[model samples]
Target: MPASSHHYRRTVLLLWLAAAVLLGLTWWHVFALVSQSRAKELANAERDLANLTRVSQEHANRTFRGADQVIRFIQSRYLELGNTLDLKALTLQGVIDAEIFPQVGVIDAMGIYTLSNQPITGKLDLSDREHFKVHVTSTSDALFVSQPVLGRATGKWSIQLTRRINRPNGDFAGVVVVSVDPGYFTRFYKELRLGQRGMMALYGLDGVARALNVGSREEFGRQANNSPVFARIAAGEEEGHYTARSVVDNVDQMVHFRKLPGYSLMIAAGLDTQSVLGNHNAAKEALWLQAAIVSMLVLALATALTRHLRQIGTEMNTRQRAQRQIEERNAQLNAIFDLSPDGFVSFDNKKRVNYISPAFRQMTGMGNETLEGVDENDFSIWLAWRCATSTPFLGVAALRADLAGGKPDPRVLIELNQRGKRVLQLGLRSSKSSSVSQILYLRDVTHEAEVDQMKSEFLATAAHELRTPMASILGYAEVLLNEEFNAATQHEFLNTIYVQSKLMANILNELLDLARIEARRDRDFRYTRVDLQMLVTDLAHTYPVPAGRSGLELTLPEQPLYLMADSGKLRQTLLNVISNAFKYSPHGDPVELKAWIKSTPNRAPGVCIEITDHGIGMSPAQLARVGERFYRADTSGKIPGTGLGMSIVKEIVALHHGTIEIDSAPGLGTTVRLCLPTYATLQDSVDQDGPSRSKLDHAIQDTRPAALS
Candidate 1:
């Protein structure tokens, strides 16, 4: 057998041995606990039974003695008046109570008749009564208590108590009897609350139950001569306990009995065994339940250990397989990390560099030098030098303060010149899952920042443009209100006011159009088919040319070239281009418009329109920004043109999936080109790059577009 299998068997045996030992100990504990519980319960029950017995006897003594005392008082009256006793008058005067003693009378020697507390209607004799027979047999001073019997006078079941009545010669005369209701003793005992199936019984010296209250019933005429419980008390036992069933109710119980000290009566209290030991049994059952639960937990732990041991070999094999796969992929990940375009670097909470990307190296001009030992202070020195050598808009001190300040903006943009003009956006992000606390990144945003600057300049230029026209309108209106002029001069001033007011209104309307189209949230354009030949011919004929300045020339293809576009916006775009051509050209130069259909590689067949002006044109620098909002080539307030016209033209062409081109120089002229797709579906004009390119190109291509110039 293999050593591994032998080891497995040994380990399994050890686990089971441990479990068996633990189970044995648990069972021992449970048995000891249960035994202790049983002993305590028995001791408590015996003590409680003794207390109950004492209480029952005291209750029986007080009631019986009270009745005996009443009988003695009645006997004194009988001895006084011999045969002519007025028992009815004594009872009527509240001297003798019929409720306590239902019948108090005396029997003659012949046992023929009797005198009672209440008058008897019929002939009631007492010669056969147990109390009368006892006195005739023994002429003693002791009271004879008999078992419950129906009274001859009252006809109610009662315990008969009699004392001997002797004549002057000391012979047996008769018996003075008292009928004691047994309910008083039984009801008193019932209040003692001996638990379920309890009893309080009174037994005579003759071993007969005189007054008994057993399980809620009162009865008599029962003999206890053969009872083991009674035999104990009869054989000179003072007090004792035994387990037996009641003779009156037959309920199984533990009976506790005590003989009255000076009387021949014995009172016993019995309680069901279940009531006495039920709590102890419950504690034993709870111990058993705990043992069962511990056993289940042990078995479950064993099963888990076995399963874990079996999986060890498989897990080892899996770990080796995963290690090889990680090794194979490590090189590819490193290559990507070095080549990423965005600069990346990490720093710990103490400002130690954890990692630095190659792009970050190039940006900081640390050519081919390893950054492994570089700390944040080293990078800070490099950053300080870069800020000094480059643009100083926000100085090195300001940038350094933010880096070391209590708190700083997470992202900050800096305008600088490195290899070329550049805008570096620096940002910090937290990394929680490493020793490194922060990662700092830098991205080149030169083109975006320059465009943003141009927009800002454009906004200022627009405000100036709007205010210039308002100033003219307000000047002419104030002059007209105050100064008197000839009819022709006033008319000229009014014309100037009208033209300036119209210029302001047109600028405001154009700004509104730009805002609506750029929103892109809803349908911005109503698409329709347009005929280029008709559009160009109409624009040429009704051209807004100055009277003695220029000619509007049209060069259109004879065949109608139709394109799918928003006609209203397209018309506005074309008119803006034409108007700018006339507005910017030298006073007598001709503004020419031409249109034709042209097709390009990977693009749909589209209409091309070129507006060329033979005027003093823009420099290369000015031409670059000609398509910006509110940008103007002429800033001297000489040319009658708002810079927004070309930008609007560019936006409208781009919306129709078209492009704009401008070719110009410092002193020559400028030509604007628009190449638009013809009436085909919008998707036909879209360009999708195939897989025949670098992966980076597919992800984020930096392409510079030129219109058909």
Candidate 2:
């Protein structure tokens, strides 16, 4: 070959070699990235499984604790009342949640199944049952959870939670067993919506499965001794995660297992190995495709460079394309900052604002304000002006001084008076990156602050209300105990103490009722079709009239108005309103209650109950604060009330999907109207196939006075 041709051949060889090296490096990077991605996916799956296992373990522990409480309660009651415990009545009265523990029974000392919340068909001997035998032989009061067994009394598959019941002298009386349905755990697991091959199981330390749900299949009393989790437990591992084939179905999975802290049971949650890696596998394939494209582009670039040895224009175009890609990435980052809910402000190295996220502008109520390139100190002054005078902000000077003094950036909460008031948690941090000097973050915390304030106020009001009655009770009791008095004087003091005690009890009860209503949100209420006319009449007749007062006067429409409501709660609401009417009107004015069918354009047709009381009516301000807790319109010492009655009434009415309107003046008396959806209107709103519709249908078919009442 000629010298020039030899030189060209050598240069081409070097170019091909460089392209080969680049392709190899590209593949290596892709493989490393895919490997890391796979590891991350597995780690995340294990973390999720561990968290699910922890939740299941907690649920099981809570269930066991609740069952033990019921057992202890029954044991004490049974020991005191003996055969007169009335388990069935207690169950009916909701002293025990029968839905959770379907059967609670007492086995006599002779091993006879004597009493139970569930019906007993015949004399059933439970002597051979492990739950019964364990308690009978061992005097220990430790709760014993038995393997799932077919109950003789209830004729259902249940796990027996039993405790040994002893007499007052510590003599063994019998066993108190609470039967829990294993399906309960499985049902709850279904709600977790684990993948089709997911598994959740509650197993005893002895390796018996109390409840196991694999996808949709449920099993109990299955032996899992050969499982890997059991081996780990045997090796003293309380909790762990491992990938292994399941002994039950031979499906490979990543299993996270945890042992209940104080119980013998263990909970395990498993995600199918293939399902867990599904996303990672897809990503790996995409990464390989991208690597192949990059390799092709690298080879093409090498060939182009070898052919066009002196091409400067091609190099410039390549640089321009790379610049465009960088700009695109920057735009993406900017989009993310703009979309973030938390406000962010970045200052350039000069400490002047370079970027302000949309969220930051909205948080500061500075809409359309040109804040870019503004000095940090000037921005701080503007923010200070926006903040409430009550909570002034520490300006940028203080923040910089702290940072210059080697202190951490200050995080402060500032309240803004603009835009209907707001609380912002402000945090500042110095950035080490060359592009920015500092970053400011603002988070809206107004809701949290409001909640804290409401809680504090409620607690303070409760304490003050309880303290007044408590002081009266303590003073009278002390006087009676220490000083001798005549029989009449002693009786009067005793009466005073009794009244004060009752007042305190009423306050506590009303507070608890309010809390329950708020927490449960009417889940505990039993809904039924109630006759509005009949209910009002019953209230009028049953109300305890004061000495100088006439009973409530009733006005009812000719046709009966029916409503879908929890009758007990509705009755409580009406009683509260009527009682308030009488309590405020000490002059014996008869409260008039009128019921009629009402309709509104914005709502469904409903029934309205208007109760008008000629009482010491409230002013506009007091009426505005009517439903506020512990707010009484009459603050005079003559009235007797906890002031929580209206609050409870409001909550109950709202739970029924009803509205209440109160109209009053200083002397014109007050008219309170309760508008509740009619049964027919509510039935129309309910789904056709829903249980509520069926219940409403059944109620409609049965119109007897007994059913209505």
Candidate 3:
């Protein structure tokens, strides 16, 4: 659609056309070179065939001329010796050369055969022999060469060459025959080293092979009348060449043949076309295949380049669209940072500020100027002007030492105070995606510090509580041992010692119980369905107290008031609270214990138990630490009890997911209210049931507020 894209596509098209043209030219050159090489190979093959033919012709001419000279000498001797001549004696004188001619004989006018090398014991008939009959019938004086025939005398296959023996009056005398082994010619031709299917043959004019060797086969006495090469020779083709399959061996060959001048014989030498031109054809095909593969690879690379160009153009359009929407996303991110409660600050690998949220600016007096050239040491000072001395890191020096590491721990806790008033805890952690980047978070932890201070005071108060009881026990025992008093006074002294010892035991037991309850890790309080009315009734009747003092006053709801809690722990908590009411109250002072089903604001519907005492009520400062472990309101060494009863009671109540509210005054009495979760809030937490008073829309119900005994 655009000018740049259109021009880009046109350029790609031209490149592809150029590649195709080059490939075509490559193939043309390959074919031209193959054709020229093939022409030279054929010319070389023709030269080899011609040389073989010339060699075979020379061998045949020489062999036959020697045979003719030998035959003439034998004929003259036969004419001289007549019937009285001893052919055996002539052969014995080494005249015949038996290695060349195995059997030499003479056939008489009656067609009887005889051997010159050995004595003929029996008469041998040879009338049917081609050698004998050719001489008898022929009128020419030339020597006749016949096809291979089995000798009646020697009983072996041999080439029979014979000449006529005529009388002085011109009557037929007999035949002088030379029996030559066909192996001589066949073995000589086999050594020509022609290709796998080359044909080397010697044949007579009568269209029959005298000796033949084609590839490794040797044949004798076979007709060659149907051969195209032989037909051409018979038609006066004395020396020529042609490409044709041999009729004898049926192989395609290039043949070079010639006829002997003084004899009716032909020599043919040929080489198979498959052997001579095979390498040429293979080289041509390999060149074509290699060129084709290279061309295809070039085309593929060009096509890939074209596609890559198109993709780049498309990507450019997409990049423009993405740029337009970046502003909108930036606004959304700013709004998110503004609304976040916790402060956030991020820094990159170079310790340079990348992003700073509005909350981070509000927590630290920093602005956009803090974004550049701010390292971890500067960030640490920005984290806090001051840090608690109790923690591992205190100042910017410690923070920078930790930051300069190959790999540092991800999370760090920074404690600081804002304007020397409010405390803040900052969490610094590595970003999840990278180790070289970090995120910082800020939260308030002022209330947590106050709780730690209260815990420290509790440990000091526990030591004082134990020492007071042990001092009283040791003082009374020392007074009785050093002075002699009345028996009644001595018994009173023993009673005081026993009472102080019991107080010490109660403090130790309460401390162990509180520690065990708080040490649990989870909501591990075992809960069961409890009938509140029956539980209070049993406690009122079973509690063992002193005989003359004012005991516990029980006020219970009429209904069941079922709850979910650890029953043993709940009973211990109630017992400890009620016992404290009686212990702090003087004799005849009212100690009332009340139970009811009620719901308070910001709490679920539950059963609440209250214990009231009119004895020495606590001040405001004392009530705040009343439930702290081993803390006491009376610190003047007068109270005869451990200071840990209320602490144990508070822990048991908290484990049941409940609350304890203490209301007290300096001169007035004190009332402790303990509220436990009922079945409505704890049905899934534990197995429990409460009374079904669904329509009692008021807060407190079934309160049984009666006068105490």
Number of the top lDDT candidate? 2
Tens digits of per-residue lDDT for model 1, 231-296: 686577898988876666666778888998767888877777777778878867876876777677
* Candidate order, TM-score descending: 2, 3, 1
Off by over 4 Å in 1: 88-98, 302-709
lDDT against the true structure, per candidate, is: 0.71, 0.82, 0.71
| Candidate 2 residue pairs in clash (backbone atoms < 3 Å) | none
TM-scores, in order shown? 0.41, 0.48, 0.41
Candidate 3: segments with Cα more than 4 A from true spot:
92-94, 119-121, 300-709
The window of 10 residues in a row where model 1 has the poorest summed lDDT is: 328-337
Residue 649 error, candidate 1, Å: 99
Error of 1 at 237 (Å): 0.5
Using TM-score as the yardstick, the better of models 1 and 2 is 2
- Ten-residue segment with the worst summed lDDT in candidate 3? 328-337
lDDT of 3 by residue, 1-709 (tens): 9999999999988987877776676567667657865786677788777777777887777677667766787787678666655666657777676777777778887788744655566888888887788877875557889899877667788998889987777788888888788888888888888866888989887889998888888888889787777778777888989888778878888888889887888888888888888878886777677666656766877544334434433653574466444321100000001122677777777666667778767655455555545776776665554554543345334434465552132235544433454455555555446534766666555455655665667666777778877999999999999999999999999999988888877776676666566665225565666767787778877877656775678887555566666677778888888777776665558788887767556656677899898888899999988876767787775555677778788777766667789998976778999887664432222233543344322222332211111
Residue 144 of model 3, lDDT score? 88
